[model samples]
Target: MTTAATTETSAITETAALQDRLDFYWSGRAAEYHAHQVSGARAAIDRELWASVFATALDGCGREGSGALDILDVGTGSGYLASLLADAGHRVTGVDHSPGMVSAAQAAHPDLRVLIGDAHAPGILASSLDAVVNRYVLWTLPDPVAAARAWRTLLRPGGTVVAVDATWFPHGVDPAMKVPSADGEDAFVRTYDPATLGALPLGTAASMEDFAEVFLVAGFTDVIVKPLPQVAELDLRFGVAPGHESRPHFVVTARCP
Candidate 1:
């Protein structure tokens, strides 16, 4: 009825539409994306670094004392990180919004139970998880702040959240082009819709502090951040996915309070 109400409603509708488009886009690219992720995971140096991070996270979250964790891997494209967590002796359940990605993950690791689910609203029971983890998924969220809040609710009290992401679009987004293989270079708009970039508040965050603040606002405590120059090194040695630029990634962890 009011002008302000109409504007707010329109913005919400538009953002939801944009998120649907993003899911479709990523689903279509699952094969290409999985190929890229496998290359990165196959790098021994990077694998070692991530393994160490997860090991430290398990200890930091008191998993070592409590026993293996019931970890939910949100936005688990291709179950790459899920496998790593399984290797760490955790009971891992993964959720992703993209069917194609779910299929890819299942195909790659038939043992992993990855379901079609949204990161912002995973539908997991409240306080049922010992940990929530993701990699490179936060930046793509239409609402990272809300997603962080939801993740906090999914974890039990004293349970921890571990996520790794980077400044992938610090200078703002460029059109993501489709590729044939891991190295295809044809230019086309597929990764993000420029008009919707504004809706993603953390999509182009300049620093790790921007990400850390989300959990802090969500009532998480004991937040810790560590820079991953090792990721940059992996990119330097093995090269990044086509259309992606290399930057230092960071692992941020926080405990539910």
Candidate 2:
């Protein structure tokens, strides 16, 4: 084979290997991650706060209250969002890459439909969903732009895509992004190696516009990024986990058109 072809094959092999490593890391971290997420969303009011955010976004497109919207929750770790949306009377299907996470979500909410699927390459039909939603997903994606563009093909015309995430790693995948788990381990530091960190453009993203422009560039229309004030308010009342204080999240809304 030529030099270029050999290089291409090696790159593909490396990427596949990295994804495998990521899957394992997330799987092993599922127990700790679920506990953390569930704790924050333990209160009914906090769950409702997030529900309202989804409601308003769905309402903007005249989807909410019109009927039961079909929503796809990508990277549905522990099924927290799936349960919330299901309780709100929407038809929700959750997709995660790790079997561990899929199991946690299913075990927590037996009735919910949670499948093992990649966040970037979901095995879903085209233009068959009313919305594609994710929480804390974009920051680590190797190709977020490609993922956003793929999501556009999954939503029906006028459907909305909502992403809830914050700049957790303002300093990229360095020691600064490390936070000890309940057991005093930082799984993120282990999972995000040099290649992983290099691939994630949003890891060091410093502004909200950085998140907003992604959807805009992906061919989505009416992209808007706004502070999740409700989340901040709840954080103040409930208290956040260590190292998360003063770190506010934002919601990005982009219309599939």
Candidate 3:
């Protein structure tokens, strides 16, 4: 089992691979994207932006213990994060919509449970989870409010939901960097305006107040929003455009009460 600080270079590289796995439309480009991200230049983008977001979300899950803590990683592409958590002694279940991603994760960590399923489905039931962690998924969902509500239903009273996602596009990169639709219809990407990104479905908007409010409405309490300080190394390397050079996404932790 490896701690955050002790994960090997290969494992870190593996984590980078998983990040590219999130653009569900890019399944064919996985290898290329993975390679583009492994250089030192890209390392900072990951550390400052992505890894920090996961760390913040996991923080709300509390500390590791001898007894196993139950956790679900929604959109658990390649299960690297869940694998790391499990290494630290948590009992983790990872679920993803992509079969390829699920297969990769399960193959990578045979000891952990990886399932092929949609986060929006009833496959996960009410009050059955201790915590739910999602990253880079909110903006992709067509119905963000319903998605949040579903997450709330899956958590037990006092359980935590930790989610992180970017609100802005790459500075010079247009949405075209991503195919408008991957599945023959304009159904894959849910385009959100800046206003929409900050609102209930996509995010709590800019205010920590609004962020907390959504969780409260979803029946959560003690919600906290933490703004991760930018890491220059991360930005220069993995950032798609200049906008990401200055701004990083927010990670929120809210507990179901």
Ordering by TM-score? 1, 2, 3
Could you give me the TM-score of model 3 versus the true structure? Answer: 0.64
Count of backbone clashes, every candidate in sequence: 0, 0, 5
Q: Cα lDDT of all candidates, in order? A: 0.81, 0.82, 0.58
Worst 10 residues of 3 by lDDT: 180-189
Q: Clashing residue pairs in candidate 3, if any?
A: 41-237, 44-233, 44-234, 45-234, 198-205
Q: Global CA lDDT of candidate 3, please?
A: 0.58
The residue pairs found clashing in candidate 2 are: none
Error of 3 at 195 (Å): 16
Q: Model 2 lDDT vs. the true structure?
A: 0.82
Better of 1 and 2 by lDDT: 2
TM-score to native of every candidate shown? 0.89, 0.89, 0.64
